[model samples]
Target chain A: MKQYLEIAKILKNTHIVGPYWKLKLSVSELAHRASSGQFVMLKVDSDQGPLLRRPFSIHQVKGKTVELLYEVRGKATEILAKMKAGQRLSLLGPLGTGFSLCDLSYVPLLVAGGIGVAPLVFLAQNLRNRKGLAILGAQKKERILCEKEFKATGFRVKISTNDGSRGFYGRVTELLEELLAKDTLLRKKAFLYACGPRPMLKQTIMLSKKYNIPGQVSLETHMACGIGACCGCVVQTLTGYKRVCKEGPVFAIKELTEEGLAE
Target chain B: MTPNLSVVIGTLKLKNPLLVSSGTFGYAQEFVDFLDLNILGGIVTKTITLFPRQGNRPPRTCETPAGLLNSIGLENPGIKVFIQEKLPYFQKLKVPLIVSIAAQDEISEFVELAEKLDKERLVAAIELNISCPNVRHCTKKSNVKLIAQDAKATALVVKAVKKVTTKPIITKLSPNVTDITEIALAAEEAGSDGVSLVNTITAMAVDVEKRRPKLAMVIGGLSGPAIRPIAVRMVWETYKKVRIPIIGMGGIMDADSALEFILAGASAISVGTANFINPNVCSEILRGICGYMIRHRITSLERLRGAIMC
Candidate 1:
C-alpha cells in the first residue's frame, strides 16, 4: 500500500480503560489505505523535546476517521495524552506489512494480552463475516480491553485475567490449550493469531507448535523510522535479522525463532 | 533561472548537495518506493566490513529529547556479500554511489576492502568510516580506541586505502574528539580527497526507573538536531585547516540546517536523522535550498561558501 505524510485532525481523545487512551483522527487517505495490523508514525508535538515519531497501530477505521489505542508510557505519549480534539497531528503511514488473511479453510482465533489488543481489534473488525474466537487477557478485570468490541463483531470472546477476576483464572495460553484439547475438530482447523507481551507470545507460539496449528504473530519493538531505513527494530527470525517495522509487526508462526518469540 | 546546486567533492561531481547519510538510507533501494532516487545528490551505502557483523543485542536504539542513541554495532553483510548481492542494485542507480567502509583493528582489512571495491566501476567514491562509535577494536593493544580518535592511525588507514584505489577517498571523522581539525589535517596530508564530519557523538542513556543503560551495548552514538551546532563548528574548524572539501553532517534536518553547514564552509551537506522523521525530507531540503538561493539571487553556492560574516 502507498504511505502518506498528512496532518490528521483529532476528532476525539478520551481515556478508554486503565492506562489506555483512545485517539480518533480524521485522516481520509490513511483511513482508507491502512489495513489490519498496519501502523502510523505519529508526531506528538511540534517542539524538539519529543522529536522522534512514535508508532501507533491503526485501532479502527471508519471512512476518514482512524482510531489509535495507546498507553502513557514515556515523554512522547504523555505529550500525546494532553492533545485535545481539533488538534492536528502529523502522521506518516499505512506502513509495514500487515496481517495476512488469505486462507479460508482455517478457523480464525485472535489471542491478545493487555494493550496488544490494539491491532487485534482492527483484525477482528475486518473478520466480521468469519466465525472467529478472540481470547483477550489482562492482569485484572479492569485491564481487559476491547472485550465488548470483539464480542460485538459476532465472534466468541473469552477473557483471561491473572487475578482471576474475569472469565478464566489463569493465563490465556492455558485457556487456549484447554479449549484446543476439548475440541478435536478445532485442533485441525484452528488458525491462531496473537499479539502481546513477550512471555505471552512465547507461550502462545509454544502452544501453537505443540498442536501443529498454523499461526501468525504481531510483534512490538522500539523503532526510529517505522520504515525499513532505520534498521532499529530488527528481530532475529528463522531467515536472519528482519525489520519488525517494515517486514512485519506480523509474521507466521514458523518464520520466527523461539528467541524472537521471547523478544 | 535555477540556482546551481551541483557540487564537486574531490574527483566526483554531484547533481546537487543533498547526499543521504550512510546507515540512515540503507543500500538506496529502501527509499525507491518512497522517493525518486535520481533527485538525490548521491547515495552512501551502509558501512561495510571485511566480515559479517551481527550488531549489538536487542534494544539497540532509544529516543532522546531531540536525538536518537543507537548501538547498532555496524551490522552489515561482509564485503563479499555486498559485492555479490548489493552492489549490483546500487550500480543501476542514476546518481553517484559512495561506498562507506570500516575496519576492525587492522589497517590491512581496510586495504583489502578498498582493493575489492576498486574494480567496481559503479563506485563514485570511497568513504572511510574510521569513526563509528558503536564498534570497538578487538585488538588487545588498541584498547578499544576509535581509529579516527588518533591522527596517526587515521593517516595510516587513509594512506593504506589510498595506495590501492584511484577512487577519491573521503574520510568520515568522529566528533567525539579533542581537536577535529587535527584529524582533518592528517587525512588531507595522507591524500584524502575530502572529509565528512561528524559521525554521531558517543553517548549513553539510562532508564532511571530500571537503573540500567538503555542500550545493550551501554553506550551508543547520538544523532539528530541536538548535534547540529557542534557539527557546524567542527566543519568550520576543519574547513579552515584543510584545503580539501568538507561534507558536513549531523542533525541536518532541513535546508536551513544544510545551508548553515555550507555557510560554515561545507561544500556539501548530508541529511541523516531527519530522514527518519520524513522519508521525503531530502527532496524537501533540496527544494528549500533552491528556494533560499532563488530568493537571495545567489547564482552559485561557491559565492556563499564560508560567507559567514563574523
Candidate 2:
C-alpha cells in the first residue's frame, strides 16, 4: 500500500533483445518497497503525445535502483525507448499484488512469454535462496530474456522459441507440460507462477487446474490510474470485475476464466 | 499575497478551488498512500448507483492524443454499500467529501440515493451525475442517451434529488449536446445550488490495423487536454446563462488550465484526467495556483472568480 511518486532518474536503458529494453531508475523510495511480482506506473514523457502513465512490472530492485523490462509496442514505449541516461521520468510504484512466497519448501516454477519475464525475473531473484526454474518463451530466439540473470540467481533456466531456434520447439506451456510430466518430484512440490500473453496465461491456468498445482498470474491491460480509483484496468473474476491495480496486477490462477469474463 | 483560495459551492466551502473530479479519484482512500488527502480542495467520490455495477467489458480505456477515452459505465458499489462500506472511510480523510450519484432511468432512484446518503453526517454535498455517456439503458425510455442532454430531464432529476436531500445539490452536465447552457439554466431554475460544468465529451478511437474500436463500449467519454477548450467554452456559456456557481472540470491539469476555468467564470475547478498522469498532481496544481496568486497580488478567490475581462 506504500506507493511513491518520484522523479526517478534513469541510470541506464539498454536494449536486451527484439522490441525489448531494460530500464533502470534510481528511485530508492519506490525501488526498496517493490516486492517480487508488483509493478509500477511509469510516465515516459511529459505532457505531449501520451496522456496516461503506462504500467510496467518491477523487473528488479537492486539497492536504490528499480529495473523495468518493456516492449516498444505503443506511443509511450516508443518515446521511452529513445530517452537517455540522466533524464528523469515520473514513477508510481511498488504497486499491486505481488507473488506469494509463503511456501518455504515448494520449488518455484516460473513461466513467462516474450517480455512477460520482467516480473518473474524479479520473482526469481527474490527466490534465489530456494531451488527454482525459469521458463521463458519468445516468438523467436532473438526475443528471449533473463537466462543469465536467472542462472546467476541459482535457478534453472529454460527457453522456447516459436521457430525452434532454442530450448524447446513449441510454446512455454508445452515445455511446462514436458517438465511437469517427466519429473514426479517437481510435479508434487512445484508451485507454478506465470506472466505473459493472455492466451498463454489461460493455458497456464488450465495446466494448473489439470495438474492440481496452485499458482498465480499477473494481469495487464490499459489503465489510466495505476491505483484502484479509475476502475478502468479490471478483469472479470468469479467475484465480479476486480481492478488489476488494487486487487492485483497479479491474481490467483483460480480467478481467471478461459476467455474474456462474460460481461 | 497567497490569495485566499477558498471557494464555496452551495454550503460547501472548499479550502481551495482545486477539487479532484469524480471517477478520476476513486473513493479518495486509494490515494492515501501517494499524497496527503488534505492537499485537495475537495474529493468527489465516483458516481454511485442504486446497485453495484460491473461496468463495461474489458478494454475499458484507451489513450488518444492528448486525451483519454473511458467507458467505465459508472462502475461503483451501490449507494447502500457506499453508505456502509465507503462512507465511513471518508469521515477520517479531513477533505470535504462530495458524493456523486447516478440513477439508471428513474427520478425516484436518484431521490432514493439522495435520501439514503442525506442521513450520513460525513457527506458534504451531493453531485447528481446526469452526464455520463457510456450508459444506455438508463436514458432509453426518454429517447435521450444521457440525462444531462435534455434540459427538462436534467431539471426534473436535480429537483427531485434536491427535495430528498438537505445537502447542496450540484448537477453534473455533459458537453456532448449542442448547447450546454440550456441544461445548466434548467438545473439552476429547478433548485440546484451549483452546477459542475462539462463532464467528459463523447468521443471514440479505433484500431485501424485490427479494424476494431479502441474501447469495449465502442464509444466512450473523452476527458483530457483535447476537450479543455470545449469544457471551458461550456463553462463560459453556462456562466453567462445561470446565476448559480459553476464547478468547472474537463481537463484542468495544472494551475494555468485550472485558472482558465476560473477566469471563464467558474467558482471552482476539478482536476480530472491529469491525476492519472501524476498522483501528486493535485498538490502540484495547488502549489502552482498559490504561486500564480502571489505574483498577481490577489487576496481572495472572489477577486479571481469570473474576473476575466471579455
Candidate 3:
C-alpha cells in the first residue's frame, strides 16, 4: 500500500525503441515497495479541469523513481504529454495487488501487448538472475514499444508485428508457443505474467490455462478514488466482487472466473 | 508566519478546517499512503447502517460536465463489521474520526447504531447521514420540511448517543431542501452540536441513445464542481439562520473553492467529489489556504471565516 506521492521531477521523455506511440514518464519516486503489476493514478490537471485522475500500471521503477508507460489516448494522456519538468503531480499509487512471482523458482516468461509491455519490463529487472524471456507484440513493427529496454536487461527478447514487418508476423503468443515447442525445458519451470489490453489478457489467460502454465494478468477498470472507497473499479471474482484497486490490478489465472473477462 | 490553521466545529478544535466527506474518504486507513491524516481536521467515514448494504448496482457512478453522479446507496460493512474490522484502524489514525451513520426502515436502527458507536472513545464525533438522496424512499419523504423533521428526530437519537459519550454530534444536511436553513435550524434545535451542509443534490442522467435513465438506480446524487455555487449559497443561508457551527462542502476541489465555503459562513469545510478528480485536493487546499493567508497578511484564519461581503 504505497501512499500518494508528489512527483519530484519529469526525467527523460524519450519514445520507446520501436516507432510505437507509447511514451514513458520517468517520475522521481522510489516505488521499490511497488511490485511488478501495481499502478499509480496521476492527476492530469492541477486546476481540477479534469474531474478524475488517470490510473496507469507501473511499467518500470528505478532508484528513487517509477516509470509510467502509456499511449496517447483521449484528452488525459495528451495533457500528460504536455507536462514539463518541476511541475508537481499528486500521484496515488502502488495500488492493487501487483504480479506475484516471488514463489516461482525457475525462469519466468513475461508477455505484453502494445502498451501492455510496461509492467513486464520492471518484472524482468526485478528478477535477480535476469532469468526470464520477454515477448512483446504490437499492431505493426513501428508500434512496438520498449524493445531496447528489455534487450539491455540481458533477457531473451522476441518481437511480433501484425503486419509482418518485424521478427515474427504474428502475435506475441505465437512466439511463446514457438519457443515452447522448441525448448521443452522452457515450459517446465517457467511461470508466466502478462499485462496488456483486455482482449489480449483474455486470450493469454485462456492460452495459459490450456497449456496448464501458472500465470497472472493485470486487470483494468475505471478507478475513481483508487483507494478502496467508492467501489467504482470493481471486478467480479470467484469469491465475490473485489476492488481492482484494492484486490488487484493483477490476479492469478485461476482466481478470476471465465465470466469475469470481457469477452 | 501564519497563526494556525485551526478552527472550531462545535466544541472540537481541529488542527485544520479541511476534512474529507463521507463516502469519498472511506475509512481513514485507506488514505495512509498519500495523505497526512494528522494534518486533516477529521475524516468522515463512508455511511454505515445497521446492516451491511451492498449499495446500488453499478454503473454506480458517472462523470458529469464538472461533477459526478453516484448512486452508491451508502454501501458499507455494517456497524458490527465496522466495529470489529474498521474501528481499530481509525483508532490508529492521527486525526479525529467522525463516523457517518445511516439506516433504513425504522428510526430506532439509527439510535441503535449511534448507541453502538457511543461506547467507543476513539471517535471524536458522529456525522449523521440522513440526507442520502440516491435511493428512492431513502428518507421518510422527499419533502425538504419532512427531511428537516427527520433530521430533528435523528438528532434526538444523536443527543441520546451523546449522553453515553461526550463526542460532538454533527448532522449532515441534504441539498434537495426548499430551504436548507430550515433543516439546519431544525438540527440545531434538536441539539445537534454543529452541522455540515450539501450532501449531494438529487439528480438523474440520460441515456440518450436508449432514451431512458442512465443509472440503474434511475437517479443518483450529483456532486463535484457543478454544485459548488449551490452549496455555497445554501451554506451561506444556513450559517445566517443557524447558531451552531457549519461545515460547508460541495465540489470543493481546490483551496480557492474551499475558501468560498469558509467565506460563505462555514466554520470548516469538507472535500467530497473533488477527491475523485485529484487525489491530493485536500492537502493542496490546505497548502493553498496557508499560502493565501501568508500572501494576504491575514494574521488569523478565523477572521477570514464567513467573511463573505455580499
What lDDT, from 0 to 1, does candidate 3 have?
Answer: 0.76
TM-scores, one per candidate: 0.94, 0.97, 0.83
Q: What TM-score does candidate 3 get on C-alpha atoms?
A: 0.83
What is the Cα-based TM-score of model 1? 0.94
Q: Summarize candidate 3's per-residue lDDT along B165-236 as a digit string, tens digits.
A: 566889888888667787787778777889898899878888797786766677888998899999999998
Better of 2 and 3 by TM-score: 2
Where does model 3 exceed 4 Å of error?
A1-4, A15-33, A46-48, A84-92, A102-107, A128-133, A151-190, A209-211, B1-16, B54-63, B71-73, B92-94, B134-167, B202-219, B275-284, B287-305
Q: Residues B1-310, candidate 1, lDDT per residue (tens digit)?
A: 7998888987899988889898998887777766788999999988999999877777889988778999888889899999999889975679999999998767788999999989999899999999989887535556448888989888988999999999999999999999999999999999999999999999999989889999878899999998899999999999888999999999998899999999999999998888888788888899999999999999998877888999
Interface RMSD (Å) of model 2?
A: 1.8
Ranking of predictions according to TM-score? 2, 1, 3
Pairs in clash, predicted candidate 3: A3-B33, A3-B34, A4-B33, A4-B34, A29-A65, A51-B277
In candidate 1, clashing pairs total 0
Judge candidate 2 at residue B149 and give its lDDT: 84
Instruction: Please identify model 2 stretches exceeding 4 Å from their true place.
Output: A261-263
lDDT of each: 0.88, 0.87, 0.76
* Interface RMSD of the candidates, in order: 1.7, 1.8, 2.2
Question: Against the true two-chain complex, what DockQ does each candidate achieve?
Answer: 0.60, 0.73, 0.40
lDDT (Cα, tens digit) per residue for candidate 2, span B1-310 = 4578888877888988888899998888888877788888888999999998889887899898889999999999888888889888976777889999988767678899999889889999999898888886355467777888898888888888887888989999888888889889899999998999788888889999889998888999999999999888888888888998899988888989999999899998999889888878888888988998888888887788777897
Docking quality of model 3: it rates as acceptable
> Model 2: which docking level applies?
medium
